[model samples]
Target: MGRKVTVRDKILETAATLFYNQGYVQTGINQIVAEADIAIGSLYKHFKSKNDLLYSYLEQEDIRFFTTVEEKLAQKKTPREKLMAYIDFRIDQQKTGNCTGCHFIKINAEIGRTDDEVQQLVQKHKEKQKNLIKKLVTEIQPSKNNFDAKQLTEMIFTMIEGGVVAATINGNTRSLEDIKKLADKLI
Candidate 1:
């Protein structure tokens, strides 16, 4: 017989969906176990508390974002092309029926109550996004204000994040189209 997966894993998966769809505070541990069809004790066995589960969710999401970016980047021919693919990928995510708001934004709002691990994870993820934009900017604009590429990369990041927020709020995709246009101007 195949080995059964642990109940803790099941609870975390259910908890992640709940936390993602419903806000973190709005989703309770009881709700997670009930939805997971597992005993309440199962979660505590794996995670020290709800905070542990929340941190794990944030980590998983950060991994998902970069992993998707890498997979998409590999198919393109140049850094510039890969960068366009990055914007198109965001467009695809905006079109996804499940996208609420960017998970990082939501998680950022909750960091006041979160542990250092998750807060650090958020900080690290933000740095990665900035760096990715910096790499793309390097390919297009070799000359810049500083070695860090902060100003230009940050401008692009704002446009990208703004598109996600607008899409979530209005439930319309015009913002993504606008972003693509703006990116064309940037490049």
Candidate 2:
């Protein structure tokens, strides 16, 4: 017989889905327990509180996002190709996921100000993303005369974030496509 899924795993999985689909604040422990088909005691045993659960969820999201991106980027040869691949990946994510507008962005907007841990997590994620872009930009432009990798990294990051917000609002990939075109020009 197959091993049964742990209650903790079930709660985390259910919370991830609900938190991603429904907003974080909109999802409650009771709802997670009900959806996960686990007892409240089981949830409390795994996570002391909702904040702890959120932390775990954020960690899971970070790992999943970076792992997926690294795997996709590994397929590209040149830095330019890698950069473009990132843009394409973001666009595809929005298209495939029905344009949820970025889990980090949504969570940050919801709890960043009030929750220091969540805010830090969001900041770290953004910094990592910017660093990746900076590495690629350096390879492509190499900080030559009048070319600033840091500035370009920030610009590209902002464009991508804006594109995601626009896509979510417009319910189409036009914004992401526009960003990709702009990135192509910049790169």
Candidate 3:
């Protein structure tokens, strides 16, 4: 049997979908309350404000994203393979059609700058992602090539992020595929 969904889960789920499909600024608390089938007082009780809900959403997404990525990485034995798995993971996400590119990036573009808390959350997410890549890169066996680990990490991070943005804008995974190919050659 499935676990029962709580009112807070309903609110977050509804808000996440709306915030992803529609802009955060365009989505309102009343809309969330209506869609979530919860009372305004309940939402307020769970989340102090819209910004509070946004933070909660981001935190939830961060956990979900990293957990999935860790599972994906676990399938591969080598650091290089893990890196490729990460790219493949991103590709699969783009193919799913549910992805609004990178949620952190989208949120940042939306109101990250205006909202200091949101901005910090987004920055923290990106830093966590970069650090993951750095960990994998550091695990890679040293090769005869002259590549710097730091530079390689930055390059891979940029390519992956840039590819996601391109794929999102073009509504296709060609950019990600191309990046995967280029990254495979580099690493």
Candidate 4:
């Protein structure tokens, strides 16, 4: 038999589900404890505060998001294919996730300004994503007459971000599909 899940795992798992489905500010510790079926003391034992739980959640999400993206990207043979795969992955996620916006983006909008730690975590995650795109851009278009790899990366990244936001607003994946088409043209 496998090891049983700990109370801390239960709390974290419940928080992740709640935070993803509901807004972070809207998800209370009591709700997490109630859904997790754990004592209030158990949550405090694992996390000092709600912010602490959020921090842990963000860390966990970062690991999971990047790991999944890297795995998907690894399956593609070419840089353009990898980039397209990234866009398609996001589109599929949006469709399956009920059009919920980016997790980090949502959390950042909630507490990015007030919380330095959360802000840093969000910034670092975005920077890493941009760097990955930059690396791919370098591979796809080594030298353009007027545009550098960094500039192209920013444009592509912006398009992807805009696509996600648009898709969320429009309640469809057309924006994401359009962005992919634009990216195809650019590449």
Worst 10 residues of 2 by lDDT: 142-151
Tens-digit per-residue lDDT, 102-139, candidate 2: 88998998886899999988888888888899999988
Note the Cα lDDT for every prediction shown. 0.79, 0.89, 0.87, 0.89
Q: Using Cα atoms with residue i matched to residue i, what is each candidate's TM-score against the true structure?
A: 0.86, 0.93, 0.95, 0.94
Report the lDDT tens digits of candidate 1 across residue range 36-130. 98777777878888888888888878888999999999999877788778888887887884447777777777665346776788788888987
Better of 1 and 4 by TM-score: 4
Per-residue lDDT for 1-187 in model 4, tens only? 9989988878888999898888898999889989999899989999999999999999988898899999999999999999999989889989988788888988987776899999999999889889989989899984434778878899989999888888888889999999899888777
lDDT of 3: 0.87
Two-way lDDT contest, 3 vs 4, winner:
4
Clashing residue pairs, backbone N/CA/C < 3 A, model 1: none
Please report the TM-score between candidate 4 and the true structure.
0.94
Maximum-TM-score candidate: 3
Off by over 4 Å in 2: 1-5, 142-145
